[model samples]
Target: MLQLKLYYHAKPYLPWRFRMATRRFFAKRKRIRYSGSWPIDPPSGAVPDDWRGWPNGADFAFVLSHDVETQIGYNKLDELLEVEKQLGFRSVINFIPEGEYSVSERRIQELIERGFEVGVHGLYHDGKLYNNRATFESRAKRINRYLKQWGATGFRSPLMHHRLDWLHSLDIAYDSSTFDTDPFEPQPDGLGTIFPLWVERKIANPESLTANQENQISDRRSAISGGKSKKPNGYVELPYTLPQDSTLFLLLRESSNAIWKEKTAWIARQGGMVFLNTHPDYMDFKGNGNASSFPISYYADFLQHVKESYGGQYWHATPDRVASYFVGCGDR
Candidate 1:
């Protein structure tokens, strides 16, 4: 954790090119070490024990999501949205509530109006939210406020740092902060399952409400007063099954999206979720900047592949819908 703090704290001081080169060097070593489990971990293909398959009899589920980290990334949302819209896909757009840029309510409403789900990425993109229990509890209040203001129920923490048990404080339907298998993140622990898992909220004392609970009491008096509200039903943990774009393009320096296609096929064969989390920050629509961006066509081509290769065989839903369905499916 201390190492993570130092890395994120010093991130601004380090040159972007230096960080990219350093990460690439370490990623090369990790690729060789975790070749068997990464990208397509055969062990992670096992379906949940009580799985009843996707709704509408679809063979598998596909979800798309993005974590906008900076102003540059936020500016590219329109372009990215157009690409997905043209491909007949929509995704959750998570924005940092108090990051380097300011997101207006108008933009949030526009995204919600366009069939894209809005979610709180984090208060800030820094890696300090989980430094300790007290810090998380404090920040969870602010995160919940943004969730309510944006009318969103999904969240994905910056840099994928997470503590699922502690996230119960936030008023979220699901969290995409974990992945099935990725040894490249600061917190590289994988849940080892491709399916969404139920994380029941902890029973809290009415007399001793946590920061988030106290903040929501006005809007949810009955639930907090007697602890009978369905909000306590807990949130879903949606771990991205596909390798991230930055991981493939920047760190590993892949020229194409073959790994995404290969892993999508494998997950589909296993009847698991083909959940993908990309970043608008790393997508190069201009077809340049290899240091931090990949050709946008790589993502476009992958979407087309999914549509053409397995048309009508997969259920494409947003992360929030997936969480609601999982909870409403009577599986819990």
Candidate 2:
């Protein structure tokens, strides 16, 4: 039925009706499985045995991210760097290659020199990457190539739009596109909470082009590692555990940083990862050409809170470092 529906939907683009008919004929044939489940392995990477030492021995990590668009001019970047320096925190900035604002190679290199991590934020800021496989793959490859040039190994699909099945093709070390939103989970039983999980792709056929190609992506859904324990995949999935700054400030009509502070404290206590997302276009003092006054003081004060509250124990690192450390790619 699934194949039949796919064929019907694709019929109009084919040159002949027989193409549809042929697909219909084969659609009824179900592939047999020797093993019901694919063989999956626990993450052999260096994951923390316990998450209790972060933020003053509380066992949580705060991953701050910025989605930088073209509209955000250089002035905003300068302000952001100042705020970061004041807080003693470094963040990952995901730059869209084809957006209202483009991040230059020099700027990206500068960020790296300053202990910040650069990441891919899609070729364009359009929200259509997850609509299909072909387009998504092409865009992913382009973004991946650019990231490699910039010395980045992580990705966050635009707007958090993701097709989990297609993510394996990107060749990124880790993905931060998953979230705990109630409406998005595939299975009825949620991943339970907004914790980071491993997303493993199961290659149903070793010989096919897509086989051994990371097809069956699963995370926090079942047991693995000889059934002694259940684990996510080799690819770490750092989900957005809290509302983005845009959602809180604009969508929720919030003018103060109180909401963010409250949520940060809550996630810290849970010993889980606190993934905070913001946009340079929104936070920029010059409005990044978007015309809104930059909230520099508010952002700085927020960072000050984290610095004072967490003290030196908080791992003030970038998202790339977090991903690398989680996957055992970098030194802890």
Supply candidate 1's per-residue lDDT for 203: 66
lDDT of 2 by residue, 1-332 (tens): 24433544565577644653453344223112211111101121123454324433545677788877656443467778767866677888887777776567898899989888888888876556765678787887787688668777678876576666687766565678766542222211223344556566665653554433323222211111212222233456777766566554543335778866776676666566767777766674643433233365567787788778866545555665555455442121
User: Which stretches of model 2 miss by more than 4 angstroms?
Assistant: 1-58, 73-75, 182-192, 206-234, 284-294, 329-332
After superposing candidate 1 on the true structure, give the runs of residues whose Cα lies further than 4 Å from its correct spot: 204-233
User: lDDT of model 1 at residue 130?
Assistant: 94
TM-score leader: 1
Instruction: Please provide, for model 1 over 1-332, each residue's C-alpha lDDT reduced to its tens digit, 9 standing for 90 to 100.
Output: 88998898899899989998898889999999998998778888888778888999999999999999999998998999999999999999999999888989999999889999998998988788998999899999899889889988888988999889888778777889999999999899998989999887666565576777555633332222222334444678899999999899888989899999999999999999999999999999996766778999999999999999999999999998888777666534
TM-score of 1: 0.92
Q: How many angstroms is residue 180 displaced in model 2 relative to the true structure, after the best TM-score fit?
A: 3.0
Measured with C-alpha atoms, the lDDT of residue 270 in candidate 2 is 56
